[model samples]
Target: MKRIFLIAALICSSIIVLQSCSPKTTSGAPAVKRSGVTGNWVLNNITFDGIPDIAVKSFLGESSYKCFIGSTWSLTNSGNGSYSLPSSATCAAKTQTIFWSVNAADGTFQFKKLYQGDKAKNVTEGYRLMLAAADDVNMTIKSPIEYGNKTAYIIMNFSKAAK
Candidate 1:
């Protein structure tokens, strides 16, 4: 079982998940969205496709995906980052440390939970989200879940928040 939100210090660079989004720049060079992954981000909303809202009990093994709305995420260049869950009427306030990275060519974003004294290399189980889009101010990641012989997606929408 794994928790969520681990990337390192915000040094100004991040993941580039743009396999099909490799638009050529003015100079005809491939544009990478690496810079879009770093910095402070807020999970503004979550949308589900082909899955009932009541079907899921938790997201990332932490809490209900509904509870994740408004969560703040920080992904650093060093592969260390954290997400803060603000206390709500139904959700408790929590901050989780994580180690995260992306397979840019494949448009995959993955992260592992970091418990005290736990090494990332030793933890094999992690959560993966498909990067639908990641620009300077917004990012969309999709978590695919298998349900009743069908694949459903949990779409997370995030917007950048300046430090």
Candidate 2:
């Protein structure tokens, strides 16, 4: 009888521990805001097969008329396996929200930009966000969109501020 009670107690304790260890899911609402991308991000490198590298560099660097480093943006977790940018509208004529959904196991982030227009909008405007970290270096950026489409993608990468 004593052994049976001990085993039951152990089982209950194990169940509690497992439940506590699980990660809680967000309910498609904005949860935590990403604070890492609030500042400037400079372009270090860009590559796109078939297309001219200059085009990628220009978009990533925002060199034509806009500066990616100077553009003000914000990041917020959508709680539904994605994140929203600028919970408020700040860009000119760009009343849209951008999202970044990354696989927690793979680190490959999908970049999406959703517009507020009556039209269905476009996904070609979406890109990917990648991150790499090592003992000596850490990098983050919006990667290029390879698909041919009418929308343009602005990809940029940045390193963390030096200590």
- lDDT of the structure predicted as candidate 2: 0.43
Q: What TM-score would every model get versus the actual structure?
A: 0.78, 0.37
- Give a tens-digit lDDT track for model 2, residues 11-120: 99999999999998754322222433333223343334445545553442223323343333333454122221222232232223555554544444555655555222
67: Cα error in model 1, Å: 2.0
Best by TM-score: 1
The TM-score that candidate 2 achieves is: 0.37
The number of clashing residue pairs in model 1 is 11
lDDT of 1 by residue, 25-69 (tens): 353222335566988999999999999889988999776887789
